[model samples]
Target: MALLPVDDALQLILADARPIADIEHVPLHEAWGRIVAEPLIAMRDQPPFAASAMDGYAVVAADTAEPGATLRVVGESAAGHGFTGAIGRGETVRIFTGAPVPQGADAILIQENARPLETTMIGVVEPVQAGRFVRRAGLDFHRGETVIAKGAMLDAGRLTLAAAMNLPALPMHRRPRVAILATGDELVPPGADPRDDQIIASNSFGVAAIVKEAGGEPIDLGIAADTLAALNRSIDAAQAAGADILVTLGGASVGDHDLVRKVLESRGLELAFWKIAMRPGKPLMSGRIGPMHVLGLPGNPVSSLVCSHVFLTPLIAKLVGRTHHVQAVDAILDVDLAENDLRQDYLRAAMHRRPDGTLVATPATRQDSSMMRVFAEADGLVVRPPFAPEAKAGDAVRAILLRHI
Candidate 1:
């Protein structure tokens, strides 16, 4: 099969993937980090009524004159209780923050700007205008207004807004369940003493972590031997567990023992794309088996992780109906780079903010995709296009940030 470019492959994968239709209604507290399935509309106007914004004296604007003018305080209004008396000319009402302004009063003069006098009267230190410090009804939000839109991911701020809008629960897309299967005859589970030819099966753990970070629930299917029967059984178990996405590590290349693609085809999965023009992940494959989307990742540790970031994250986001997508930023290179190979490269790099506020990226000394230590210490990936030439200091480059460095 011909190798497809990174962009083309991604576009193809996304073209067929659709947002999951299954939704679950959860309480507002459990809705955090979940995607809203429907628009959340305000049931009632915020504030509901005109109220005071500070502890002050509510008075008719016409009654508030220049300094030395005194008005009789008719009544006091606190937060829950409101003054029922109508303010006539030369009359004022003592109102605290959030208290409903008295009838006929359009403005409030802060207590600091008023001098309390005997016999329920106070003198205005400064002339006050009408409608000042008054929070009108629906100032924050009006009834029937969309407080949150569908596909919006819930965060702390959004959750608070939903609660304030009287939303006790929300319908959100169900989180996708992902199954990770690691395959290799020479692979052993972590902490197991293995023969000299066997290496710890670490790809499943890393892939599971990536899936979790991407908001999907990962179900580790444990290590599958290189035998065809064992691999098929693992795939069957994952399907029985109701996994929405299945990820198989290793057995994707053209080597004699490589059997992932063959097994998937035999099990009736339609192949989408098998090869991509990406270093450390050229053998990546994606397809659909029954109702589950299956991804075949390269056996290398770094390759599995890179492939997960490139493909799995977006898949999870799409399935969960999230609107926001991951993006890469352009940065200036701080060191030289040699000529690139035919495949696009994702070199592990460290990112830092320079003194002048420009982003600076430096590639790690070791560019081997099999090394996990380098990937652990790296903050992002420096993207190099296929067939590109060497890069010098201060060269503009694109970087996909993993997290804030």
Candidate 2:
């Protein structure tokens, strides 16, 4: 088959993919980063009453219209226990912060502006205005109103708002479970002694980090040797674990030792597409095995990691009902770049901001796919289209940011 364009391959992988419909109810304390499955409705108005915002005396605004006006203090209104009697003309009530505003009292005279004449009377030294220092009913929100829409992520501010809405728990989308398997005869787990010809397995950890950051749970299936039997055993374990997505590293190309697709095909894998038209990730493959989605990533450390950021993160986000995608912002090029290839290129680039606040992206001199250090130091990937013209320093370009910066 002809090499699939990057965009086309992505469309095929998610053509039938839908966000998980399962909903799990969790307490507000455990809700951070989870997608909301239901609208957050307010059970009652915040504060539930017009309360005092300061330690002061509640009096009729007209009664305190003149300076040095003496008013009789009827009773005290504290939080949770409000003064029930009405304040007649020339009358006031002792109130504290958060206390309910007493009836017939339209304003508050703070203690700083009042002089206690005796136990039952107080003199107002300053003129007061109506509705001053009184919090209105339902100022924040009303009862039975939807405060948060569905599909919103429960962040710190949103979670606190939900608590104030009288909700002890919230409905959230189920976290996606991703099964990660590394396949190679020359691979071993980290901290294990590797023969001269072998190297420690590290790609799965990077991919797992991406999965977790996208709000998915990652399950390590360990390293599988090149043999089909070994690969099949790991795949079986993934299925048994009820994994939503199966991610296989290495063994994706057409080499004799590359058996990821062969093993997946034996399990009736419906191949979607392979050999994307992109540099450093040409041998990428994607498909579905029964109910589980499968992604075959390239063996090179940088290639696998870049593809995870470009492909896997969005897939995990979608599975958990979050709207996510790769984004590229325009930046100024800091160096000359040669181009003209059939496949698109994503060059590791460092980002810097000018004193005037303009962003500049400079591609590294070395972009070998096996170098993890280059990828680590890079803040973004400068995207160059297939068969694009050469670019010069100071040219305008677009780059996909690695971090929000």
Candidate 3:
């Protein structure tokens, strides 16, 4: 099949993906990063009653219209111990912040604005308007109102609001479970002794980190040899774990040693599309086995990581009901770039800001897909369109940032 464009490949991958239907009740403390499965209704008014917003005297606003007006201190209202008696004309109640405002009191005369005339009398030096320093009932939210909408991610602010709404727990969507499997006879587990031609496997670790950051649970299926039996065993393990997505590293290309596609097809895998028209990730393959999605990525460390950021992240975000977008912003090129290729390029580049706040991107001299160290030091990927003309320095370009810088 002809290679699919990068955007077209992504569209096909996400077209049928939907948010997880299973909802789990998570405590407010543990709900962070989870997607709300339903609208959160307030159990009661944020403040059950009209309350004081300041430590002051609650009095009739009409009675405190003039300066030096003295009122009898009838009672004290403190948090959790409110004054039950109503305030009459020429009477005031000593009220602390968060205390229920006494009935018949329309305003609060703050302590700084009041002068003590006697033990039971205080002068209103500054007259307070009605409702001043008073937090009306349901000021924050009303009972039975939807305070948090469905599909909202629980962050610090949202969690705090949920707590104040009297919600101790939230209904959240179950995070997607991803199974990672590394393939190839030349690969071994990290820290393991390897033969002359064998290399340590490192792609699964980076892929797992991406999955976690995208709010998906990653299950390591360990490394599988190039043989069909090993691949079939790992695939069985992934299905046993109920993984929503199975990610296979290496053996995606049409070579004699490539067995991922062959094994997946034998197990009833429905092929979607294979190979993208993009550099460092042209061998990318996406398909489905029953209900599980399968993504075959290139063996190169940098290629695997880039594909994860470009594809897997969005798939996980979709399954969790979280909004995800890969933003490519305009930047100035710091060096000349060769052009004209059938495949799109994602050049690892360093980003910096000029004195005038203009962003400048400088791609590394060597952009080999196998070099993991260069990818790590890169701040972003300088995107070059397929078949674009050669460009000189200082030309405006576009980049997808990977780091804060």
Candidate 4:
């Protein structure tokens, strides 16, 4: 079958993917990068009580407005300590930041605007407004309010908020375990002394790294020979490992050595989609065997990485309950593109910021998807849509940024 467009293939894969169940609870400290399974409701109003926002003298605004007015500081209120004394008319209390506002004192005059008469008294140097410098209870957050919503990714700030709300732990989804299996008789593991016909199996490492970056745990299943028995054994091992996702590195095309489709089907797997009309990754395939989602990537180095960026990353995000996940972006093209073929081309390019503050992407000297060195040096993929006529300079183009230029 001919390849489908990239967007169509993505729609098909996403339609079949189910969000993994949220079935784990982790302590707040260990919850970083985890997705919240439930909404985090505030146990108490933030601040819990009315507090002073500054170090100043709390007083009755009606009496403190008269310049040089003297008021006795009934007591001192420091953070974590409440002034039990009440401040009636012509009475005041010395307060510090975070201290609860004393009763009957509706306003505060900052120390810079007051003259200290003693440790317990001060002369008002300026007028004070009612309720000034008082942070009302629940101003930051109300009691029983949802501080963080479900499916939110926990970060340092979110964890701090959860702790502030007295949540000792959070319900989070378990990290998906992904198994990466590289297949090919001509491929050897890294550090092996390869024969002239053999090439180092480097795609697995890249795939595993991408999996980890996408919030999934990658288990490298090592390289499998092109033979059916070897590939079947490798698949069995991956299934036995309880992997949530199984990613095969090669043998997804129609060639005689491309045995991934047949092997997966023989094991009763359901094929979702294959052969996206995207350059460098047109042979990609996705399916499911039992409970495990399978992603078959093209053998070429750049093709594998591109497909990972397009499909695997989103799959991992979906499994972890993450939303709004997308790759980086760039500005419009600086030059024209020739007529496109039937496939979408993800051209490797170097992207940089121009002096005018616009993002400019230039395609690399070599556009071959198998060139690992050039792929490594590229900062993004400049997208070229299929059937597009000649594009002139200044035409808008979408590019997925890979890294800093």
Task: Please tell me which predicted candidate would have the highest TM-score against the true structure.
Answer: 3
Candidate 1 lDDT over residue span 100-180, tens digit each: 988889999999988988979899888778899999989999999998999888889999999989889998888889999
lDDT of 4 by residue, 1-405 (tens): 878888888777677677788478898888888888889899999889888999898888898766678998788899878888787897888889999888888887888988988877788888888889988899989889999999888888898899999899889888888999999999998789999999999998888888877888899889888888998998889988889999998898888988989999999889988878889888888888888999989999999999999888888888887753566675767666788899888888877897888888777757888899999888899888898788776776788888865
Number of the top-ranking candidate, with lDDT as the measure = 3
Candidate 3 is scored at a TM of: 0.94
lDDT of 2: 0.91
For all candidates in order, the CA lDDT equals: 0.89, 0.91, 0.93, 0.85
Q: Please give the TM-score that candidate 1 achieves against the real structure.
A: 0.92
Off by over 4 Å in 2: 72-88, 93-97, 110-122
Clashing pairs in 1: none
**What does candidate 2's lDDT look like per residue over 50-117, in tens digits?**
88999989988898877678999999999989999888999999999999998899999998999999
Minimum summed lDDT over a 10-residue window in model 1 is located at 318-327
* Runs with alpha carbons beyond 4 Å of true place in candidate 3: none
Q: Assess the local accuracy of residue 206 in candidate 3 as a C-alpha lDDT between 0 and 100.
A: 95
In each prediction, how many residue pairs overlap at the backbone (N, C-alpha, C within less than 3 A)? 0, 0, 0, 0
Q: What is residue 343's positional error in candidate 1, in angstroms?
A: 0.3
Winner on lDDT between 2 and 4 is: 2
RMSD from true fold, candidate 1: 2.3
